[model samples]
Target: MHLPIELDRDRAEPLQNQLYEQLRGLIIARRLKSNSRLVATRFLAEKLGISRTTVLLAYERLISEGYLETRPAVGTFVCAVLPDLVPAPQINDNRVDDLPQTELRPPLFQSRMPVGEPVEPALIDFWGGPDFRIFPLKIWQRITQHVLECYGKGISRPPPSAGIDPLRGAIADWLAAQRGIIVDRDQIIIVAGAQQAYNIAARLFLQRGDRVVIETPGHAGASFLFESLGATQHPVPVDEHGLLVDALPDGSTSLAYVTPSHQNPIGGTLPLERREALIEWARGAGAYLIEDDCDGDFRYRGMGPPSLKSLDPYGLVLYTGTFSKTLGAGLRLGYMVVPQELVASTVAVKTLLDNGSPWLEQMVLAEFIASGEYDRHLRRVRKTYLERRDCLIAALRLHFGDVQLAGVDTGTHLTWLLPASLPSAPAVQEAARQRGIGVYTVSESEIGGRPATLYTENALLLGYSSLEERQIRDGIAGLAAALRDHRRAATG
Candidate 1:
């Protein structure tokens, strides 16, 4: 069979290395199917004008790595049992009946606020969190490989319901030194991510028909999870400081979800006074506060704000954090620092949820943090993200002229309050999409509660961390042109 293979003989790298890299890329990207047959070495070499020996060597390396295999007489084929090439699981129709009858009934679809529209491929994605380019890939790769080698034996065994002990220990030490919260490792429950952590928290805390206080225009994931679990959501307004403690509904609020370090969507950091007041209110109301510190690692300007858990003398807070934002979302490693009284119930719920997170990732992350690589990595990315944030602010000001911005003091992204004369946030977002630039509105996120005019009309959320400086400038330029064209058409 003819193969789409190209070789650069003039390049400094060996032809074999190039062949291996290309093949690896195809396999990783899932372009090459499992058990697919390959062209003979002779035919491949002839096609690429390379020596047959080079092609043979590349095939041999791939075979050794379990990415390819050869049958003595059947010829060469991609490995059907490649570690990373598992077939997609077929959905079982019978599983639908396994859920309870009440849950089987379709939920009443109560429409809530709109979320940020997804960025199209043709558009620059500046709406997601974190700068992927600045993630410590090299360091993380080393740690991952090292952990696999050193902890392979342990990881191969079934992980405990509580999670990897060393990882929980590492997290405990991290919290003590970084956030000033002292707790036993047993109190920590490792989960897939913050959303899963919220699920567990809701399961443990919320009863049906219970009232839950959520930050207005907060992280959509938490709000949705609470509602899914049958908690009647009470929207608490957030101003320049943070969630309005006075705005919380009177009576028993089972759970209060907040992003106190850097409020999601708006990026307002709750001050110490407000933090104290909120905690006091929680104590009086007998409520549980779920503090999501998803982007707390990238505080750009001030001294680190104290986490809500740090100030909780009565054990009213459940702290949720994830490496997805700091490292990458692919890691799927996060933990919930539960109150001592609730730890047992939380762990039980975690066990029933998914057993526990993958053992290797937790071990590697533990070593990464304990060896101080994690802190160093955070420092590097924090500086890079801060610079990118500044560049985005500069670009917006240069193009749009005197834009009002918020949430830039901390977190990976900030909100730009669009001038009334230009266009609405959603309209500008749609216009930007036509010009291949991604922008967002609060309604596009995991927001609950009734639609307020302020959320839909004024604010455009721009995540600057993910894009390169030139990409940021170019994207904004594209958006400016789109807006101009829009205005021209409107006037005409």
Candidate 2:
């Protein structure tokens, strides 16, 4: 049988490591059947187009892991005495000493955040655009006022570490009803937003030098958070379909942070097959998967993919979400749901982070969501954003004449892949700035990522959720004119 092995030279993972990973995954997934003879290194390497030395190194490690064995004068075969493969027992206490398992190891500013009250910016900004127009301010105001009215000044006492009771309950219910993630309220920890959640997960699971994989051209805020904790960075490149799961290295890592729902700046969703493969990869490597669904709520594509948490059966996915995108960033409120295994450590570390998020906002949001006003609000915003997304597409097409755009299927921004006929992304961005229109390139839009010459150098990220149809049209028009002027100057 031809053993299934493939490698991508462009991947951030080393050739040997990628080879080691796929073989191990095949065994763990039971795709490479037990006692099956593997192909010889010389022949297999030639078949896969890799150096024979690379295959030998990968095989050596798998032998050490008991995934494969070589019988004298026979051939390499799956190990008869396979290591135990079962979910690790959950730790009942909050100690960092939990048994090894898929351990619960475990930033878009600029779409309209509030300043006391939200205001429209003077420049026609395309990034960080939040719909402040129909924010249901009256309901939010009433709920905030009611929380103070009922609780009096005594609401200042330290709230539960897990979160305010009603808020946690509301979030739990909302996840089940909308996202198909069912969990108890206690499993949720109210976070300041997604940023603090990343910090908390790092504190709980990441030891120094623990490898953390992040999507290339991913949210820089996430990469910075893990790096701050002294975790090593391993960046996996993303494509139009989403995170490339086959690139995950076969080694111990504390966590892998991915924006599967609408991959940060690129806006691609991982299909179910890749999601399942990723979960299996994590299971084999004994790492946790932090699934950040920052914009999963507003998917333009047909019936978006399910949350990784929803598909996780081995207790390997740490799901992080925020209201900053759906409601408003001013709320500064988000929540994370831990598998029952990691709840104790997660809450303990979260308490150390902030002692808990602000009490009043929790109470007010709890009331808003439970009373069903939050659902109504989402319905209003989703329709508006869908319309806004369509308008942006129409405007770009009209002005640029067959421009390439991405992330349109979800999230607030769409990446405009600059045509070869035009100048580079940075030049267009500068020209647009001169016209008082805000457009961001990969460097500004995504978290700290190594330059992907093809995507980052020639792409401009545009956010349209906060702009009106008229503004979207004018902004594209302004960019078109700026590009024309830039071309004229270059020629002269």
lDDT tens digits by residue: candidate 1, 36-113: 888899988888888999999999999988989999998999887776554444557788776877686765754343
lDDT of each: 0.83, 0.83
The reply for model 1, stretches above 4 Å from the true place, is 1-119, 445-449
- Best-fitting candidate, scored by TM-score: 1
lDDT of 2 at 185: 88
At residue 425, what lDDT does model 1 achieve?
Answer: 89
Clashing pairs in 1: 114-443, 114-444, 115-443, 115-444, 115-445, 116-444, 116-445, 220-446
In terms of lDDT, the poorest run of 10 residues in model 2 is 109-118
Separately for all candidates shown, the number of backbone clashes (residues 3 or more apart, or on different chains) is 8, 7
What are the clashing pairs of model 2? Answer: 106-201, 110-128, 111-128, 111-129, 112-128, 112-130, 220-447
